[model samples]
Target: MKNVILTQEAPAAIGPYSQAIEANGMIYTSGQLPIDPATGEMPKDVEAQAEQSLKNVFAILKEAGVDGSNVIKTTVFIKDMGDFPKINKVYETFFTESYPARSCVEVARLPKDALVEIEVIASNNKTNIK
Candidate 1:
């Protein structure tokens, strides 16, 4: 069975998509923009933007009953490659040992002109404390 995940802790989907979906013991999240769920605004710097984006991703994962350690893979999209290191620093705060495999790329643009966006895939077996 497939389950659609939704939570008020993260920014709502801007389009016709669920925040995440779970099936076959795996949870897949939609790319999360830096928009704050309460303010509907993005932070100014790459570090803050990265943090917010990952927070949104984490919220969805939490709603699906998993955590960062359960994640097996991730994909990040950024408006600029120059912000990679800054974003990576924030990324480290969210994930620990046995980090999930990830692919990050610089893109020409992003929805709402967000500086960073992140999505993840996680197993539903266990949760990790952040």
Candidate 2:
């Protein structure tokens, strides 16, 4: 069975979609932008935006009873590839030694004109439990 996950800790979905969903012991999160759930504002810089986006993703994971270490795969979308290094710096802090598989790409644009966004898939398996 599948369960829909929602939390005010993360930004509200702007459309007809859940923030994340859990099914068969796994959690799938939607693309997270830099909007601060508390303030409903987007950070100005790419680095700050990246940090906010990661935090948003983590909030969803926490809402689903998981963490960054539980994540198995992730997809990062940036408006400019040149910002990869900056984003990576903040992104690396979230995970430990065995980092999750990830794909980072520069897209033409992103929702809300945010500089960066992230989506993650995490597992609730024994091996990944913290």
Q: All models: lDDT?
A: 0.91, 0.92
Q: Quote each prediction's TM-score.
A: 0.95, 0.95
lDDT of 1 at 39: 96
Deviation (Å) of 74 in candidate 1: 0.8
lDDT of 2 by residue, 9-91 (tens): 99999999999999999999999999999999999999999999999999999888878879999999999999999999999
> Which 10 consecutive residues of model 2 have the lowest summed lDDT?
121-130
Candidate 1 C-alpha lDDT tens digits along 12-97: 89999999999998999999999889999899999999999999999898888787889999999999998899999999999889
How does model 1 score by TM-score?
0.95
- Least accurate stretch of 10 residues (summed lDDT) in model 1? 121-130
